[model samples]
Each structure stands twice: as C-alpha cells, then as structure tokens.
Target: MQKKLLFLCLFLFVEVITAQQDILSEQAEISVLTIGPGALLNDSFGHNAFRVKDPVKGIDLAFNYGVYDFETPNFYLKFAQGKLNYLIGLNYYEDFFEAYISQNRSIKEQVLNLSQIEKQKLFDYLLNNIKPENRRYLYDFFYDNCATKIKDVTNIALNNSIQFNDPRDFKPQTFRELIHSNLNRNSWGCFGIDLALGSVIDKKATPEEHMFLPKYIYRFFEVATIKNSNKPLIKKSNVLYEKIDAPVPSQFLTSPLFIFGILGGFILFITYTDFKKQKQSVWLDITLFSLTGIIGILILLLWFATDHKGTHQNYNLLWACALNILVIGQLLKQKTSTWFIKYLKFLVILLCLLTLHWIIGVQVFAIGLIPFLIALFIRYLFLIKYYSNRH
Candidate 1:
C-alpha cells in the first residue's frame, strides 16, 4: 500500500510538472504578429507576403497571406517648378509610351523605336482582351513616356511629399523606410532617368495628356516590375479588362447594377400592386419580404466582402432580374403598406449607393457592412418569432 501510494504521488507530480512546463513554453514562444516592414509595402499596395509559421526551408511554420496584388506603382517627386510630378514607371512606362506611339505610329517609330514596338505589342494585347476601354489609361501611360525626357527625375523623401502614397496606408507608418527598402531591393536605388525629367517638364497640355504621359510611364516600370509585385492579378485583370469592351463610366456614376435594378423593380412592384384585395396572409407578406431581403442583401454583401477588384460577375444581375420578376408577379395580386413601401424605398437607395461604390473601383470589404448587419438582425428576429408562434 505504501509503495503504491508513493508511485501514484510520483506520477501525479510528474504530470503537474509536465503541464507547468508546457504552459511556460507556450507563454515564452507566443508569437505577437507585428506587421513587418516587408509586409507593410507589399500588403498596402494589395500585395500579400505573410510569413509562414512553419516554413519548410527558411524557418518554422509561417502565416501564408495569399497572392500579391499590385496595381500601377509610381514615385512622386517635386519638380524644379515646385509642381508635383509623379513618375509612373515599369508597367506604365511601356503603357504610356505605347499609347503615344499607336496614335502617331508613323512618327513614333521614327522618334522612339523601342517605345513604338512596346506600344504596338501592348495595344494589340489590350485590344484583344476583355475590356478595351478600361485599358485606355494604359494607352495614355504609353504616350506619357514617349513625351517625357529620360533624365530629369530626383527622389524626394516620402514625408515631405505625400501626394501619391496609398490612401489605404496614409495614416502613419514607416512609408519612407518601405520606399527606401523597395527602391534598393528593386535596383531603383537611384531615381530613374525619366523621374528626373518629370521634375523639370511643365508643359501646358491638358491634364489628361500631361498626367497620362508621365503618370503611367512611371507607374508601369516602378509598380509592375520593381520588387517583383503582384503580376498575376495585374495580368488577369488586364486580360479580363481587354476582353470586355465597356467605356469608363463618368465619375458621377457610383452604384453596382444589380442593386439598382432589383431595388427599382421592388419599388415598381410596391407602387403598382394592389395587396389589400388579395389579402396576402401576414405570414406571406413577411415571408416574401424576409426572403427577398435576406437573399438580396446576402448576395450583395458577399460580393462586397470577397470579390476582387476590377472584376464583376453578371450572376448578381441575373439573380436580381429573376427576383424582380417574381416579386412583380406576386405583387400584381397583393397589396403592400405605405410604411413598408417607404422602408423598401430606403433600402433601394442604400443598395444603389452600394453599387455606385462598387462601380468606382472601391473595394467592397473596405466599406463596412453595418447596413447588412442591421437588415440581417431584423430579418432573423422576425423569422424566429414567426416560427416560434407556429410551433
């Protein structure tokens, strides 16, 4: 008995020690994820380079932030004239140079041989893609380079000049550090020849021509190629845009199509349908509204939440059209209330705003889902009460 008790005590003590050791080790090794300087620049410009928690080759496991998302990158510098000049290099360099060449191919070939060839190839590639018009800026980017002198640029510290920092990360971080690091890493350690030139040239051309020529040329080279940025997204988006030939909407147009279309149909249904005569059961009224509201809002919210920038799926439109038809059909025989109508009208306006934001190249996720949250809470509350009574 004594021996057994002693062994049992020893085992319990061992277990306690093991547990304590584990707790201590865990506390000691806990990784507080500080946003690394590397991650800041990559993620800010829509690139993802998260550390692997258990990296197979370099370190232990690292967190994986999937694919880098890069758009046009530019280095903004103050010119000799004190006006801000943005050098859009890499992706925009070829882009702007090409656009000018295509317009004056005969002249450009003579004036800028390398630029003309690059532009011709780019134009051919763009015209063959999904959206010829969206990529028009690409043409302008090409033009800008052809006009820009190759040696008038100088790099200014990002602090004194904050004209073109990603608005997303404008709120205080080591932006200057990131720029320095990126420039050094990408062989852009010295300011480019064109960037130097941009600082001196203050042409009296229209904003489009002036901006386009310099902005895209600088963006193309610096943003697209330097630092080995998010080429896949750019390639995919560019390819997708090239295939579709939609003209750029005016700045005033802001909403997504499905939001407005569905809301418009809902409003018309409420306006024209006579619900009193049909005597739609309270359950039916709630059911129709709840179902439509939840589904519609979910679709929009999901699109806002996860959909990538510069891509729109027409499935949302198709769903809206179908839902509108059904709602209209149902309302033809039933009547809706004035209060209910007003609520729906308000919903429509919000939905229109949502669409507009979407059309303007704003990320949906960045826009909070407060409206959707409220709609969901109200809907689920009604559903729970209605079901509870039936049961």
Candidate 2:
C-alpha cells in the first residue's frame, strides 16, 4: 500500500508540470508597447515593441526590432549608405520597462484581443524572428522601421485579419510634416533632415502609412478591428509609465535660424562693401561657391550612389548647383571666359526657379535657408550688374 501511494504521488507531480506547460497558451497575453520620444535626436521618433507574458510558463519578454549591432563590419559606412541591418532583441519585460523609465519616456501598452491560438501564433512568430539568421532586416525610415515592424508582424500573425480603421482624430499629413512634428524646426537635427531628405517625403502619406510612427501605431491600433469577427483588436489599454514634466532649456542662440541669419547678414555686408568699392571680393565668391558646390556633390552622392529612397529626385540642386565647382577657375582668372557672365545669369535663373518650386509645392526647402536664399539672390543680382559693367 505504501509503494502504491508513492507511485500515485509521483504521477500527480508529473501531471501538474505538464498541465502548467499546456496552460501557457491558454493563459498567455500579448501586447504592443509604444514608448514616447526621448530627448536625443536618434530617439526623437520614439519606439515600439511586442510584449508577451505567460505567468504559468514563467515567460515575460519584450521583443524589439530597433537593435543595431555597432560591432558589425563597416558599421558607419553601411549606415551612411543606408545598408545598416537592424536586428531583433529580446529582453525581460521588467528590464525593458526599467530602461525606458530611466530615460523618462512615457510607455503605453495595448493588450491585444486575440484568441489563445492567435496569441500562441504571435508568440511563436516573434520567437522565430529572434533567431540568429532571421533577426536582421533592412530598416527603412518610412516603411520598415521599428514601429512598422510591430504592425507588420501583428498583421502576419493574424493572417491579415486585422482591419486598421482610421482614428477619430486622424488628420492628413505628408511624411515630411509627420517627421517635422517631432522636431523643432529651428533645431540642427531638423535642419540636417531637411537638407538630406528630398522631395519624396513631401507627398501626402496615406492613413495606414502613418503607422511608421510609434505614436500613430498606438492611435490606429486603438481603432483597429479583426476582419473575421469585426471585433476590436485591443482588449485593454494601460499606461505603464508617465513621463515626468521637466523644463527643457531653450537653445535659441544655437538654433539654425539664428546662426544662418548671422551668416546671411555677413554675406550681405560683404556684398554691399564690394558694390561701394566697385571691386569683387574673390575670397567671398570662392567660399560661397566651394560650400554650395560641396553640398551639391554630397546631395548628388546621396541621391544616386546611396540606397536611401527618400533622397531620390531631389530638387535642391537648383540652388546648390554642381556647376559652381567647375566655374571656380573662371572666377579666379583676371579676365573670365565670356561664358562666365552667362553662368551667373543661369544661376540667377535657378535661384528664381527655386522660389517658384517652393511656391508651387514641388518641394519644401528648409526654413533655416530663408536668410541664406535672400542673401544669395541679392549677391547674384549684384554680380550680374558688376560683370555686365566690367564687360
């Protein structure tokens, strides 16, 4: 009798362990966590990740797709060429929350309204994605970054059953405007973005395309539904952490507009002095041409030589003409070629065309360039008059 009782006890223990494993799928919960933007330029767009929890199975993990291995070969070069590979990272949910909390960023979670099978499917998909070979993927700012990865993976798990309905407070916006919303126009980061990215982002982004931003992901997911049942996709929503209110110190002096305005003023002052003296300042012309020419070269490389889709079909070339570099020789000569005057005339026309482009919405130039553009226009006019009189 004692032996038989011992056998029964062992059998029950084994059964309990098996039941716990089985209950993981039934009791599991999956959620999408959206983190608010941070103070740094890199984190300005915020982040998104998937959270899977199963207390019965002792599984609580967050899967993030924003992980980039800096140790990879030619990391900086690949990054500049837009060939950087981002990888999926898995971490304990507690650690993930703590990291963002330390940064003082807000965290919101949307518990998905999915069946047990669907939850298991999503969990399995994430696990598979984190595998060594499957983890790395090409990252695109607009279409396939961290935020859009979550949306895509979730849709895949649901077998395209998710219907992302438009949010009640939705507004039509261009990709560039969406980006600008997260950035202060006067900031250097904003200036660099406006300088590098081209007119491709100026077009209106569709409602679904807005999910490229994490905040928009949270908003649209709130209204999304399952195609099969027409039921809401989010079972519950929770704010895991609320960012503390902190006063950001104003950086007015270092802003793009202020600095550019000073430079523009100096250029105009030089031109005015040159006009009064009736003598061209060769050094000033050299500096202007060299800078614009270098910028034009870089823009051309980014457009044609790199994989950055947003840099294609750039129209900033009108003002930062590559021909400026080729014409530097003529500027240095005592008697320039007859074509030099024609080139100056052509540059003036290009500047005028740039203004037309801005007015007609062909492209939106940087606000910081306003002062510089005005300065360039006046200088070009002065140059045209100067050369014509000299001839």
Candidate 3:
C-alpha cells in the first residue's frame, strides 16, 4: 500500500510539472534589460538580461548568461587558461533591477513583440536551461558572451525569424576599437588589455558580431523586426533608471601613460649619464634585461600555453626578448664577448621590425607604451655603443 502511494505521488508530481509547462497566459510579457556601465573594469562594458513576466502565473524573473561560481574547482586557473565555464543565472526581476540600480547604473527595458507562442517558447527554454546540467556554457569573449547570448537565445527560440536592422548611425569597427569605445584609452585597464591581448582583436567585427556588446544589443534590438512580416521586434522601450551625471574622475596621475612616461624619462636620464661617463651601468643593464626577459616569457606563455585566442600574434615580443635573460651572464662580465655587441644590434633590429609592424597596421600596440618604447630604443643604442667600445 505504501509503495503504491509513493508511486501515485510521483505520478502526480510529474503531471503538475507537465501542466505548468504551458501555463503562461495571453497577458505574458517578455523584455530585454540593458544595464549601463559601472565605474569598475568588470562592469565597464555593461550587462544584459531577459525579463519574463506572467501576471496570471505570478511569474516574474530575470534570466542572464553571465554568472560563474567563484567556488568552482580550479576556478582561477581555468579562468586564466580561458577554460572556465560561465553559467546562466535565474533571479527575481525585482531583485535584478534593484541590484543594478543600487550601483547607480542606468537600466533600460525593451518589451519584445514576440507572439504568445514565441514568448512561451522562450520562457520555457529559460526554465529548462536553468537546470544544473544545462546551465553552464563555454564563454568566449567575442563570439559567445552575455550580450551575444541574448541574440543567440532569442533567435533559437524564434527559429531565426528576426531581422536586425542597423542603427541610424551605425559604423564598422574592429573588436579592439569596439572595446576601446567603452574604456578610457589611457586607463591602466586599457594598458593591461593592450599588453596581454594581441593583434587578432584588431580585425573588423561584422554587424551582427557588434551585438557582442550590451549597448549594441540594445541598439540592434531597437531596430529589429519579424522576418515573415515586417512587424517591429520591440513593442515598447523605456528607461527604468537613469544615472545622474557626475564629474569624471581625473586618472592622469594613476594612468598608464603618466606612470610609464615618468619611468621612461628616468631610463633616458640614466642612459645619458652612462654615455657621458663613457662607462656602462652594469646593474641597470641587468635589471632591464631581467624585466624584459620575464615579460617576453609571459607573453609567449599567454600565446602558446593558454586557450585565449586574443593573446596570439603578439608583436610585443620584438621588444621584450626572452633571450635577454640568457645573456645576463654576459652583461655581468667586465670584458664580454664580441657576439654580445652583435646581439645588442639584433635587439635593435627587432625593435625596427616592431616599428614596421606598427606602421603597416599589422598590430596596434598600446599607445601608452610609446614613451617607454622610445626610451628603450635610445638605451639599446647606447648599450650597443658602450659594448662596441669595450670590444
């Protein structure tokens, strides 16, 4: 009798869940939420989420594809290796809105003009996707991120029946340019990005690919339409919260350009002093070699050791040569070999090649590194001369 009762309860539970599958009433609404950028680097590109509301079913929730658990096994390691998985998150719509609003970020909502069937399909899809097994997805910065997922999932739900029209002021831009649009050019974040990421990001992104950003997601969706019929995709759009304008904080003192500029000047000053005395600063040479060698090794590791595609095709290796580390013993010698002078010349040639790469638009390096590169060039020339004289 107890076994039969347990079986009956299980059957009823399945039936209840099955019934709720199509429970969304005709009054259901689906919308996209665009949250504005925050001050932090992580939030600078903004965010996107889907808002699903069904008054009859008392279902109001936000669905986003940008979540990742910090406690995941090998989290930081996977993140650095670009092997981390990001998860789709489900939350109450009110909580989602309040969270962004509390951060003083602007929020915009676009009510989609999806058919009742399409709405239910999308809502159900989200419900199914939030399952533990289905929640995680391999996250790619350019191809498949939170913003791109919005378009991807919608098209999947609608069976690719939507057409995205270009905005009035649409313009083509490279991925790096697109990223730079959302960042301060001289900011430390930008400097680090330029240093770590390579030239692949300089390639142009397609119109659809531009939707990888949340702002572009909002822009394209605003002008999108149904394919079979030219019906608009967005029925209504409104700003839920508008951030008050505030004075931009000056970053000059803390910026990469400023810091690198000062360091570069010091290097030139030391080189000038060494040149005047007709004597080399052995300690300075050792320090510079060690720093450049370490940086070069790191770049090589980022390119070959990691799964990050953006770190490939780096030309910064021209300046930061790993061979410099192996030659530190030569620099320590009072009277070094003649080949050491030739090696210094070889380093200069690599710098010239780097310049050629830059001029030909092969790779766009960090502009903030300009002063440092110039200083490095002069120092290299001085070292070559000093070593040649000793030889």
Candidate 4:
C-alpha cells in the first residue's frame, strides 16, 4: 500500500509539470534575444537565444543552442575534426541578461507576434528540446550555429510559415566575407582563420543564409512576415542594454602581418647574404623545410582527414610542400643529386602557380602572408640556382 502511494505521487508530479508546460498564460510572451559581439575571437560573431516569459505563470526562462563543455572527452580533437556535439542550454531570463550585460555585450529583444496557441507550441518545443536525449546537436559555424537556431526553431514552431524578407539596403556577401565583417583584418585571429580555412567559404551566401549571423538574424527578422496572415513576425523590439563603444588598444605591432613581415625580412637577408658570398645556410634551409613541411601536413589533415568542409581545396599547400620534409637530407649534403635541383625548380614552379591561383581568384590567402610569400618566392629561386651551380 505504501509503494502504490509513492508511485501515484510520482505520477501526479509529472502530470502537473506537463500540464504547466502544456498551457501558458494569456500574458505569456516569446522573444528572440540578440547579444552583440564580445571582444574575444570565440565571441566575435555575437549570439542568439529564445526568451519566454509570463507574469501570470511566473515563468521566465532563456534557451540557447550554443553551450559546449570543454570537459567533454576529446574536446579539442573533436573540435578540430568538426565532430564535437554542442548542447542546448537553459537559464533564468534574469541570469541570462545579467551575464551578457556583465560582459558589456549589447542585448536586444524582439517580441514575437505569436498567438496564444503558437506561443504554447513554441514553449512546448523548447521544453522538449531541453531533454537530455534531444539537447545535443552537431554545430556548424555558418549553417547551424546559435544564430541560425533562432531562425530554424521559429520556423519549426510556426510550421514553416515564415516568409523572411531581406533587410533594407542588404548586400550579399561570401561566408568568409561575412565573417571578416566582424573581425579585424590585421588580427592574428583573422590570419589564423585565413590560413586554416579554404576556398569553400568564398561562395556567396543566400539572403536567408545570412541569418547565420546573429546581427543578420535581427535584421532579417525585423521585416519577416507570417506567410498566410501577412502579419509581421515581430510585434515590437527593445534594446535592453547597449554596448559601450571603446577603442581597442592597437595590437598592430604585435599583429600577424608585422611579425611575419619581420621574419620574412630576416629570411630574405639570410638568402641575400648567402647569394653574395657564394655559400648556402644549410641550417636555415633545414628549418624552412621543416616548418613548411609540417604546415603542409597539417593542412592536408584538415582537408582530407578531418570533416571540416571549409578546409578543402587549400592552395596554401602549393608553397608549403609536404615533400620538403622528405628532402631535408638533400639540404644537409655538400652536393645534391641532379633531381634535387629539379625538385628545387619544381618548388619554384609551385610558388609561381600559387601566385597565379591568387591572381585568378582560385583561392584567397592570408593578407598578412604577402611579404612572407614574396620572400619565399625569392628564396626558392635562389635555392634552385645555388643547387644547380653546386651540382
């Protein structure tokens, strides 16, 4: 008799919780929360979340699809291979607002114009989404990230009835360009992105596809409409907090371009000195070969071994030849085989082709690599001539 009572109480508790989720108060509201970009590279693209509140129901919660735990098994490895699973996160609305506000990020809310039944439907969807089995999802930066989740989840809740209209004065841009809009071109972060990602991101994004960014989600949703009723999707909008505009201390001297330029200058100086003295710097050659070879191998892994689509068709490998690693023994030798001279010439040819690829827009490389690439071209030419004369 006691066991039966305990089971009955548990059932009642679950039923009551379900009932509460099944019906929202007439004063219930749903909105999309857009948080502005933060200073860090990871937070540079901004964020998006759903806000649900009801005074009568005493319910106010936030749901976002951006949560990822660093403690997850093989986190870095999975991230590199694009196999990491991100999670849907839940928070009290007050807590959510406080967190971003504390970080000095702007927060804007767009009150969705939804019917009572539609509001309940969306609320139900959010509750269902937070279940342990349903919470985790594969994250794609440009296609299915936190911002795109707002658009996707809304469409799902509304039964795909939204007609997204382009914002006023909207201009189409490539995925890479869209990302660049939020980044400093001279930043090391930007340079790393350019080096790691390939030409796949250069294709122009569709109007709806631009919602991949949180700011664009706000812009597009500002004019979005319900297809059947022709009513605006958003009832109103409010800026809860505005980010303070402040100048970021210039890191230009420490930036990728400056550092790479300095290194490239040193390499050129060494090569020039070697040229005039009728000698070669074996140690320098060995170092260059090792660095380029390792970089090439890593690029190959990203392109072929990993699931990263953006790392495909990378032309940077033309300059960073993986074969250079295998040919390091030739660099140490006082005299090299005839084929080694041909190999050096082939490397020079690869550099020429890389230039052609750049000119023809086959792939856009890192702008910070301009001086470095030029130095590499000259160095390869000198290496070829030196090897030929020595043989």
Candidate 5:
C-alpha cells in the first residue's frame, strides 16, 4: 500500500511540473504572417497564419487555417456543396516560409504588441485549437476563411479588446470588386465568379468584413488599436521575403474576350443571313434556345440547390430565360403559336431590363459577356420580326 501511494504521488508531481513547463516564456513572440498571392486560383487571395516562436523553449510553429483534406470523402461534391471541412494545420515556421519562398510569393510578418500574458494566452489558444477534435471547421469564403480566422482568433486572445481603425488609404468597395482587384478582369476566373455569384455581393463591404482578404488583414492590423488603453496593436513589421518579378506569357486566341467575340460575330452573321433570306434557320434557333435554357437551369440550381451563399439572388436569369426551353417546339412547327412572337418580344424586353440592372448597379456582369448579350438581343429582334411577318 505504501509503495503504491508513493508512486501515485510521484506521478501527480510529474504531471504538475509538466503542465507548468508548457507555459510560454516571457521571451516568446507571436506574429501574424501574411503570404502574398500565388498564380493558382486557390492561392489568388493569399493566406494568413499565426507564427509562435520561442527560442528559449526551442519552439517554432505556424498555425494555418487554410488547409483542406482532399482525401476526405466526396471532396469535389462537398466543395461544390460548400460543406467541405477546412482544418487547422501546424507546421514548422521554417518549412512554412520555405514553401512560400519556393512559389515566389512574398511573406510579411507583424509582431503584435500584446502583453506577455496575452501572448501566452494566444499561444495556448492556438495550441488548443490545433487538437484533433477542434481543428476542423466549416469553411466560408467571405466570413470564416484563413484571414478571418486569424482576425477572429486574435480578437479572442485579446478578449475582444482590439479596435480596428480604418487605414487612411482605405476605400470602401463591394465584395465582388474586392475579389476583382486580385484577378484579371478578362480572365476565365473573373468570368466564372461573375456568373456564379449573385447580386448580394454588390453591396459595399464593411471595414471589418474587408479582413476576409489577407492583404486587408495586414493593412487593418497596421492601424488597429487596443480598445481599453488606445495603444497600437502592432509593435513592429518586417518584410520576410519579396517576390521576384516573372511575367506570365499571354495568349490572346485562348482568352475569353477573343472567344466570345468570335461567337458573337457568328451570331450576328447568322441573324443577317436570316434577315436577307426572309427565312429562319431551325438549327440555329434550336441551338440558341437550348443553350440558354441549359444555362438558366444551371443558374437556378446553383442558386437554390447549392449551399453557396453568394450564388443566391442572381439576376442573370433575365437573359438566360428558362421559358426559352418550353417554346423550343414552336421553332420546329411550320407555323408557330400566336403567343410565341410575344414570348420573343418579352425576351427583348428582359434584355433591356438586364441593361437597366447593369446601369443602376443592381449587379455587375462579366465584361466578356458584353458581346454575347448584344448578339442575343439582335437575335431576339430578328425572331420577333420573322414571326410577325409570318403571322
């Protein structure tokens, strides 16, 4: 009995000592590392992570919230459904920097002006978050992404005492515009975003909401203050690495603008031929209606069925009308229904409304779509005239 009690006491003493030793030392430092954007779509918006370095404790680790486990079941489906889980990843600080460096991306670090106790608290919180059960979180592009995670965790560590002052050069912009700043306006990525996302992103984003992007996090942190004491939040800043310039070769033939321009030219040519011949092309009408209808169906599905918040309330439906599908049978008939002409007229009116929406800032559309919209308008006009002449 005495031997067992002695062993238990020793075990308890060792556990207490180990627990106490886990605390961060006064010399430890915590920083926010902002990685510049890479060439890939996934890395275009850049990334943010926490760096905890303690030379005395021989500890140097980076806590990143942007990692996704592609090996997860139904990865692509889950990503499309917005149900993919992003997990907190821990890596050695040197390894993390090296990876970014190899990609030719810049790295910037900001040492936060937190009290020693606050620093230790922040370190402890990050360590706790990296635990197996606590690591995974439902990823949200606008709200709970890597940059927002860093902002949120810092706020938590400071007990919500951080006051983010807007930087002097700050300009309020819509979420879509903010995203566009990082992407080439003529690129396929920009076109896809304008197509998939809806009008909800047209509203101006709040200053705090701007932290969703990593660069904004760095900018806001540079001017942020402690709420209680009104002290600056960042003590020092350093540029760890600067990206070297390497220009990407451009290919105009494969670009969206060029391809869409060709498509629009063909549409105009077909419409002109139909006008001169005083006859409609059955195949052309079928192709146009079918393609637009399919696109409309896809838009509707993305808006209603998908978990993507930005896809809701889309107004692109005005041009890609789903009603086009129902009237496809009329094109095959020798003489169409009386209401079919009116339907074509209605489509023309809807196109006008789409222009109105664009002008009034109801939604911003892809610039590459301009030629397509013009061609579609002219095609509808031709159809209206053809039906009227036959009637």
Candidate 6:
C-alpha cells in the first residue's frame, strides 16, 4: 500500500512538471509569432546570415513564426516572441564566446555590500593563488565548451593553416594580419564580438555556418589585446586626460574654493579672540576639533553622495580627500607645543609629490600612494631620532 501511494505521488509530480513545461513552450511560441521584423533589423539583421521576419508586411526572411517589431524609434520596445526567439539565439551564441565561466565575483560581493578595500583584498588573495598558467587553462576550458565548436563550423571556408580570420574576407591567416584587418574595421563593438566568438569556434565550416557578420565585428578586434599574452597593465589611459570637458574643470575649482573659504574664516575668528587672557589646552582642543570635523565630514559625505561629474552621486576618493583637509585644518587650529605643524607640513608636501606621480602615470593605487610611502619612511626616521635622544 505504501509503494502504491509513493508511485501515485511521483506520477502527480511528473504531471505538474510536464504541464509547466508545456505552458512555457506555448508562451515562447506565442512571443515569436507576435513581435514583428523591426527588432530584427535593429539587432541581428545586418550581423548574421540568418533570416529576419517583417511584422507589418508579413514578409519572412528566415523564420515564419518569430519576428521583430519597433514600438518606438531608438528605444527597444519589449515584444514577447522577439525575446523568446532572441533567447534561443543567445543560448546558441553563448556556446561561441563562453567567457563568463564564473559568476562575476565582484558583482556578487557588491550585492552583499562589501567595501572596495575588502573586495580588493579578496581579489588580490584570489589572484595570487591563480597562476598565469591556470588562468590560461580556465580560458581554454571555456573555449572548448564554446569557441571550438564555432571555429569548427565557421572554418570550413578558410584554409586549414589559418589561425585567425580576415575581417574583410573570412579567410584563415596569421594573428598579426587578423589584428591589422580587425583594427581597420573602425568599430570597437564589432571587433569585440568577432574576436571573442571567432577565437573559440572551429576553423572549418560551410559558408552558412561560418561567414563573419558585419555588425559587432569591431568589438572583437579591439579586445584582441585582452586575450593576448601582453595584457595592458595600466589602469588609467593617457587618452582620458586629453580632453578638458565640462564639470571636470568646474569640480577642480569647487573643492579648493570651499576649502580655502572655511580656512580663511577660521583664521580671522582665531585672530579676533581675546589675546593673552585665555588658558589654552591647545593639544586637547586640536585633537577634539580634528576628531569632530572628521566625523562630521564623513557623515555629510555619506549623506550627500553628490560628486563632481553629477553622472553618478557616489562618495569616491575626492570626497575623502576633502574630508581629510577639514580634519587637518582643525588639527592646525590648536596652538599646541608639539611639532604638529611640522608633521602636517611634511604630509602636505608628500601629498603634492604623490599627485605628481599619478599625473605622470605611476603604477600606484591612489593618486599619491608613492608619496604616502615616503612620508611613512620619514616618520620612522623621526621615531628613531626621538628614541635615541631620550636614551
């Protein structure tokens, strides 16, 4: 009796699952039948050799059921069948580029609210253990799953000796010639897609399976350097600083102006205060003010979230620098007998040196990392001097 009951439950479960799958299949079919041909022209029409359907005229290019439709110009309007068909295409295409082997670890941690420093620490640790050869193996494994099949299908037209495809003509040839051909293709996206997809796929296939599409060809070409042994080590490119655009120049002035104004006002207030009558606990006052100012600025920056460009309202390093200045100012306000001024003056000079390092394209984390290291060394020297003198 127990065996019969278990069998009955299993039968019901199978029925439910089958029903769900049927519903999904039906939905997919309906979507492909509905969205017209306009979407095809927008996305895949010029890129692939496949047929694209027309919505209004009912003229089918490749498939009868699935088609693209445009609800508005420029904006991609959602269509059911169009998306369903596209998913099928993507599933097939993902087998070609196969780059996303691991779920992007950075993005996953971001959802958990991990700080940048924490992320960097984790990434650095992971990177150290993952040797260059292992990285190549991982990439090769991904290619085996995706690119090998694509290259096999596409390379039928090409000569067997070809390692890379010609951008103008999908002929197999040397990597240098392939790079030159791709660079000449103008669009980065075109190069990116072609290189990623082409690298993995097989070298020999019929024309229908292998011919390189014009769209997204440039994307694959530009990113070829990424795949090569010579990866770009520099994070910031010289091209970024070439143009003096809006908000950048404005932001530069804004930070300094606000800093100077408050500083000047504080100086005047101190001058006006009663001369010799006050018993000043200068060190204590300075420490308290600096602590309070730091806390206040941190709170403000956290709350405000608006930065120079206004493209994104986030508290980046610039906000931190501004806050640091305020804290330093507060520290300077106290008439302490200690060498706080000298310490701060040295820090300022160090910061200037670091800024110069960054401007000249130094391979350091922050703008003034080099200078910060120098300051630490100087501090160590001072510590040794103080101890030696006391002894």
Q: Which candidate is the best by lDDT?
A: 5
| Model 6 Cα shift for residue 312 (angstroms) | 21
Which consecutive 10 residues in model 1 have the weakest lDDT in total? 151-160
Please report the TM-score between candidate 3 and the true structure.
0.94
* lDDT per residue as tens, model 5, 302-366: 89988889998888999888878888999999999899998899999999998999999999998
Tens-digit lDDT track of model 4 for 9-42: 5345434657665478899999999999998999
In model 1, the number of clashes is: 66
Worst 10 residues of 5 by lDDT: 6-15
lDDT (CA) per prediction = 0.28, 0.88, 0.88, 0.88, 0.89, 0.28
Write down the lDDT that model 2 would get.
Answer: 0.88
Q: In model 2, which range of ten residues has the least summed lDDT?
A: 6-15
* Candidate RMSDs in order: 24.6, 7.8, 5.3, 4.9, 6.6, 21.0
Clashing pairs in 5: none
Q: Cα lDDT of model 5 overall?
A: 0.89
Clashing pairs in 4: none
Please give the lDDT score for candidate 1. 0.28
How well does model 4 score by local distance difference test?
Answer: 0.88
lDDT of 6 by residue, 1-391 (tens): 6544643553454345345532221111110111111112233222221211123323222111112222223323222111211211111112211221222111000011112332233223222222222221111211121223223322221222223323454455332233233332323332332222221122233332222323212222222221233332111111111212223133323333344345445443442341223333345335433543464454344334322111122212221233443544433442332454444454446445545533553312222222323333343234334323433
Model 4 RMSD, rounded to 1 decimal:
4.9
Tens-digit lDDT track of model 1 for 1-391: 6544643553454345345542221111111111111222322211111111112212221111121113223312212122222322212123323432343321111111112233233222322221212222221111322222221111111111112222222232221222333332222221221112121122232322222222222332222221223221111111101112336444223322333345445543442342323222344444445555455554444334432221223223222222432443333334433444444444455455546644653322211223332343343334333333333
Task: Give the better candidate number (3 or 6) by lDDT.
Answer: 3
TM-scores, all candidates, are 0.21, 0.94, 0.94, 0.94, 0.94, 0.22
Model 4, residue 101: distance off in Å is 0.7
Model 6 — which ten-residue stretch has the worst lDDT? 104-113
Q: Which 10 residues in a row give candidate 4 its minimum summed lDDT? A: 6-15
As for candidate 2, its clashing pairs are none
**Local accuracy of candidate 3 as per-residue lDDT tens digits, 1-391:** 6544643553454346456655678999999999999989989999999998888877777889999766689999999899999988777688788889889999999999988889878877877787667878988888899999999999988899989999988998999999999999999888888888888988888999999899999999999998979999999999999998889978799788888899899999999999899988888889889999999999999999999999998888999898999999998888999988899899999999999988988887888898889998999999888878777
